[model samples]
Target: MSERYEYVPHHLLRRPVRDIATGVEGELMAVINENVSDAGREHWIELAYIRRTCGREFTTAISNVESVG
Candidate 1:
């Protein structure tokens, strides 16, 4: 049998994050899978930031999650 998951609103999962070094605000895109690890979370944050900022990708070390909203 296959497992099913409930859908969560994008707005609810979109978190307000900031670049600690540059102070640029951005969104932390949410993870849909429940089995994500700490490293995976970090990678997702970086990918989301890059996609959102385009060529202005921030270093993973400098991005910080401010709030989930």
Candidate 2:
């Protein structure tokens, strides 16, 4: 990992990545840390925000993506 990547705990914004399940490729636009509650329990999640070559955007679990660049 590069020094810049080491400092960024969970994201590589603007880097290219491919979705594991869908095989869709895109630029990683953002990393989102979210909290949610269910039945009095709290959960934390990390998301990969992406923009496809066709200009569409979406968020998926960070683990679902692999860096392509």
Number of colliding residue pairs in each model: 0, 0
Clashing pairs in 2: none
List, residue by residue over 3-65, the lDDT tens digit for candidate 2. 222112555678899988798999998777666546676666777778999999988888898
Measured with C-alpha atoms, the lDDT of residue 18 in candidate 1 is 63
User: Global lDDT of each model?
Assistant: 0.40, 0.76
Best by the lDDT measure: 2
Candidate 1's error at 42, in angstroms?
17
Over the stretch 1-69, how does candidate 1's per-residue lDDT look in tens digits? 122322323432345666555556666554232222353342222223312455354433322435423
Off by over 4 Å in 1: 1-13, 30-59, 62-65
Off by over 4 Å in 2: 1-11
- Tell me the deviation in Å of residue 55 in model 1: 10
